[model samples]
Target: MKPSFLASLLLAAVLGAGGSILLTHASPAQAQTSTASTDTVTIFVDATFGFRKKHMATQLTKTHAEYAARGYRYVDMAPYNENGDLVGFFVTYSKQ
Candidate 1:
């Protein structure tokens, strides 16, 4: 192996690792602002399976009532799929 080739490989590895670390880790100021802005937002997973399928309606009704009592309102829901089938939903709620 040539010395120049080995140096280039080492430099490439260091730069790649540094770039990934910088992208994944949040800075202190960003973390603080994100937490403060999202304080009024909450997420919940409502999963429906064979065992709980029968009571899904009533369960959702109670969930709505409970959150409403605490001032959180339903904002949006996205399907949570497994493989190619629907499994549950990612529900978002917000309190203002």
Candidate 2:
């Protein structure tokens, strides 16, 4: 418990805490931006289970039409299979 060693430990602790605070918080001017993070989102549609309810074709067409009206593009789709039959859908859509 030397006095010099205690002072050094106190200094290190203060510096470490200050550094942590500076790194964790962003200043006000640096926080805002006019740009968006991205223009697309991936949606997983439970088309398989819903297929029995609305009967796939009718449901899909109506949903797609709604998205198109909103200026979204249906980029890609993946069908989930269960017992060798397609049951669910994963769709990627994008808009500016």
Per-residue accuracy of model 1 over 1-96 as CA lDDT, tens digit each: 999999999999999989855543322111111255554444433444343545646755776687688887787766656566544455566664
In the predicted model 2, the residue pairs found to clash are 48-87
Best by TM-score: 2
lDDT of 2 by residue, 1-96 (tens): 999999999999999989844533322112112327546655545544423746666766765787688776787777756568665566666674
Q: Which stretches of candidate 2 lie over 4 Å from their true place?
A: 1-38, 50-54
Give all TM-scores, in the order shown: 0.48, 0.49
